[model samples]
Target: MNGPKKEIPLCEVCQQPANQICGGCKLVYYCSKAHQKLGWREGHKFKCCAFKVQYSETFGRHMVATRDIKQGEMILKEKPAVMGPRMSGPAHCLSCGKKLEPMKIKEIYDFYKCTSCNWPMCGPECEKADIHKAECKIMTDRKYKCTIKYEQPDKTEAAYCVIAPLRALLMKDSNPQQYENIMALESHLEDRINTPLYVILKANLVTFIIQVLGLPFDEDSILKVASIYDTNAFDVRCLDGSKRLRAIYVTASMMNHNCKPNTRHIYLGDNYNLAVIATVPISKGEMITLTYTQTLLGTLDRSKLLKINKCFECVCERCRDPTEFGTYIGSIYCSICNGPFGNGIEKRPMLISSNPLDETATWKCEKCDHFILSRQMFWGNNALSQELMKIRKDGPEKFEEFIEKYSQTLHPNNHLVLQAKLALLQIYGNYKGYTLSELPDHLLKRKLDLCHELLELADQLEPGWSRFRGTILLDLQAAMVVQTKRDYEAEKITKEGVQDELMESMVLLQEAANILRVEPEMRPTLEAKIEELTRFLQTPE
Candidate 1:
């Protein structure tokens, strides 16, 4: 007997062989169907799958979270996803297992034909998608060839995977307005590789096209084609130990972008999931947002990121302010005129671009009654964020200053601020000497205050019952526990008060459990923690 036929871990959902492992952090395997459903329910439906481990250099080595992760707690840490050559040579059609034809020349590289249908194979499976079927007919009549490049066997250079369905997306739709949208998308797709909106759209479109084609957009099997620098790429270090093409989707893309997103997205190795959190107190039915670009950029850089990536002029509060308002205290309302400085007011100075022969770049605040050199007032926050990334390995001590600096420079209530704070909390709470109990009273109080402020912001920024909110509630409860302990030590509170505190902690802990979610392995630990806390609260002091 052949040893039970070697039970392959078939994805319960898609029933595909789970071959590809999540490279970000190895917590899930995706054959195809299982990964997609898991990604959707677990929040990896549209993005790359991620792992459960967080890379922390804060302790000078890779550090993992000690406690059960509350939802929105940073679990996996990684660099931006990198693009690489597809590992399997001669890209095969996912549906029919047919090989894709390479573009013979650069000018004709844009054209492709379906292997089975001969309907302009964008790649092998391109013939299967309904969107491509019509276009395939049209292309078959015109005999259009693609101008895209292909990877040669001799070299390791990365090549763009020719996507067939998108080509058909250019064909006119029945609705006049919808047709116009498709045409616009076609034009946009032509130059999308250079734009941020392209990255976002590609991520989303991959999901839609996969579903329409009736192909499983699973973690291990889905194909991705893009340049090395594309932002949508995932850092799959564990699977092949090198980057390769991976699919991302757009149905999840309808949500708008923000620098400080209230909803936290997680990858389940096959799909991405979105969980709402309070980046700021959010009201019901408000727009849920995610940041398409970093929010730390100055006014000029902010505008550039938005225009380049999202393809829209951000009229958001921060973009409109010349002073980079909401970033820091200095950039707020100018002192003299009571209007925001550098916002170009009647009395305040304007930030002018000086062209030695033309006009020099400088900021004048009519409201502030002063002018600041653009260079000093306009440092690149993105560059600074990169620097912070470098120092991330240094751990909690170094981050104290960064927290203060960033909070002062960026809006205290900004989404980046929240991410940074989460990082800070992880560092402080997880590190050996940086526990909240060890901090000086004043500093500890300040930390609690900051946590409270973050919760307040989360309430406004993500109104839904998201993991982010659950994580904050857990953090707040933990801080309160420490505070109560300190108060008891100082003889400021009675034993009964501490008991009440315990009760409060129990309620908050339950709330955290209600909202926070993690991988299957960690669920047991979270449940245990909740049970332990419940028992403590139930015990008579």
Candidate 2:
């Protein structure tokens, strides 16, 4: 009493019902000579060979520098195992993640949907979409149907819990070797079960995928899939720029988290392939690290965010230092002198408890001996964030007003103030009334000052050739270019000074170009600026 062998699907390459397994891996299905040739030519053959990724327990399955990795060296680049919408509300095309037409369900149904399964698709081309095909067939076979209108906004995001796991499961049928990679990842399932998202998934996704579809997935398997996604998935922009996606990378995910990491990843091929490059020189046998959070944030916020999201309090070198590498980006204005704590340049102003690692470690001012409670700092940050959000729509004038109002209450290098200043730096050159040419000499100097100050802070927090530093470098280059031109035009500089200024501006632009060439969003803009600066430098002053 055995059921007949389950029918295998058609060729993914040609959408034909005929099946010819790949001789190399026997994972992919294709029909005809031309289609198999097309598949291999499109880079499928290389992935079929597989990457030799090693893991370890110290960093909980991490990658290392196989050799001395030079700065800006390309380490690994591969397509993600799975990709889907982020855990946020925004309706998009299920197949390609393009924006869905709002309130157009019947119209969507008429245009989209596989010929048989009736799941939403952009067109007939996506009928054989890797993750959706099997899931769609199961939904159709089990008489399960999604009741929500196809065009409903964010309906896909509401089901984020199930989509990722479903994607993982579908990968099992399509690519068994890659499925082994997925299973090898750490899920931390034991710790995740008590979380709110797990509970919700247990109630909804578990029942739908297992009970409704009768897919043979057990509770443990489903939880493991969810945990894998939670730990390994990255919020990435889609390959087509249609929408943002949570991309589950394999080797890239193995790099452990560090607040001051030596490596960074630049997504390529529309977020399909990722290039993990060294931002600093990494020696052979050294463990590679990547920052999993925004680096511009201070230690407290970075540590807390990592703990909440990744389930680990970062005790990295940056987090343990009360000085935060002498930036004092985390400290508040000392009650007495109204300056940042731990700013020990002229007079040291901070003392930590002997055990700096302890949860209750005390931070006291050396100048006024004023002890600032953790609660005050926490609430102050929240209050400032709320106020900034309220005035975010207003011009740079409002931002300056906000900064001046709290200049004494907050540290000079406080995260909020720095963020506002960064905003103003961008606005000064691009906004209508404050366009670059229209800015007064004083304002130009002000913009240049902000760029230099922020660049220095970036050197501390986001060291090496990180995206933040690259952005600041580009801003600094632009400011220097304008300032040099103004100085030359106004005859305010000697011949040698003019030459020196031009030289410095040219170097800044080239440095920025070096850093930003890897970033997809900024590369075009920075390259254009570099071309302009190169031409400007060539001309006689």
Candidate 3:
């Protein structure tokens, strides 16, 4: 005989008796469809995950794989617990987060105005967007009108700073669970107390919330909210791709940092729901990681940025290795040690940091033991970066000149040289006067070579389905098509040869399409290109 039947499960929303289990996870019960939908919108979508949260002294709270996860597998999808404008940027539409255009003298009051809070909004639909409702009421109730006039509309406004924090504070009463999630994040407030940004926030945001708006919150509490935003928020691109806004994801933010993280993320749809996808395979129990800085940056710059922004010194394998996993992206060539042809006895010894973790560490030549001051190297790279910026808009000629000038002193794969090559690659096929059909054979070959070099480095450093690699693959396939057509026109190859060459190009195109599959904005264009390429490949030569 069986024991007493298991008690009926309760609804997640109403806590009443429930028999219906969630189809996605099969763990939670809902009394009705309405309650189930409400539960998902509240939190279950994030809670249903293939990974689990774990704690460590090194990473604090971080996500770990619960099972062996395959590359390109969707690991987690979550909506932002809170979303708002970045602390500093041009005043944007409060509803859609799109940058507001400079208004004409007559159209300003009629079109761009939000009737509820007197804030800037794009249209009637945006003014009524649910995201703006809570903050709109607060502004209206307090009689605090937006003072931003149409005059000087292009200028960055400090007034925009209060919107995000205000929304977060309001969430304390309206959405306690989300407020708790925000509070659970590490703020590093003690370390940030005396910083210049903190001081500015205190004067502007804290004062406005307490004295001006009459909110029932103290200074530290408000500053903690700002600090939480600083530490955990992700830059979510607006739907139109015009600008980026700050959003705080509860579970997604818990992933720890790695220089070569195993996962990449994309914002899905207009809702800004984040989907974290594994870029590489992971064993069960392995820690899930994401890069906080650009993978293309050298160890010094990446480390410095992480320290300043995230308040943690990353000692990841890539950061500790001065050679940066043998790519030597940050190294300088030792011209004195190697002859012009390079000493044939051994590979050219590049100058690498003695201790990459220490900013003041000396960079010594591996072959001759010649040393240079770290400060000198730092400032030298900065100067070169500034020069590169100045000439970047001057076209491919300037890029080639910059690469040639720096090749003698810097390693071939140095970040600055790579930047110039990347710039040239973009220009060779896409820019006017340098289109693929217009490019000389020599220039076309240069573009192909740059694509190959960058892809090789990307595989080593970033690896898997990275957007950077996807873009390079797209360029590579286009160059291949152009080269093949040019060769066929020159009678350098037969119909069979042309088909063979294009088959290889098709493989690259397919891979690029796969990599960009999750990117909603890029997906349609890629699909159209794929269809076009398929038709061309199928046609007789």
Off by over 4 Å in 2: 1-57, 99-131, 147-157, 238-242, 337-362, 494-497, 520-523
Where is model 3 poorest over a 10-residue stretch in terms of lDDT?
102-111
The lDDT per prediction is: 0.46, 0.72, 0.87
Please tell me which predicted candidate would have the highest lDDT against the true structure. Answer: 3
- Summarize candidate 2's per-residue lDDT along 1-541 as a digit string, tens digits: 9999898767858777757776644457788778888989998767552123465555567766645667776667768888776654555556666565544454444235456655445666666766566767777888876543454444545654566688788778788899889888877788789889889888988897888877777888988888888888887764346666677888788788888898778777543577787788877777788888987776667766776677777778888887778887767656655444344456434433223344445567746677755655567678888898787644688889888998766667878888788789888877888877888988888888898888888788778877777777777777777887788778888667867777787787777777778767777787788678767767746
RMSD of 2: 11.2
**lDDT tens per residue, model 1, 203-232:** 654554454343334421222222212323
Better candidate number, 2 or 3, judged by lDDT: 3
The Cα error of candidate 1 at residue 52, in Å, is 34
Model 3 Cα lDDT, one tens digit per residue, 185-286: 999999898999899989999999998789999999999999899899998885466767889998898899999999998898778899998888988889
The predicted structure with the larger TM-score, 1 or 2, is 2
Poorest 10 consecutive residues of model 2 by lDDT? Answer: 347-356
Ordered list by lDDT, greatest first: 3, 2, 1
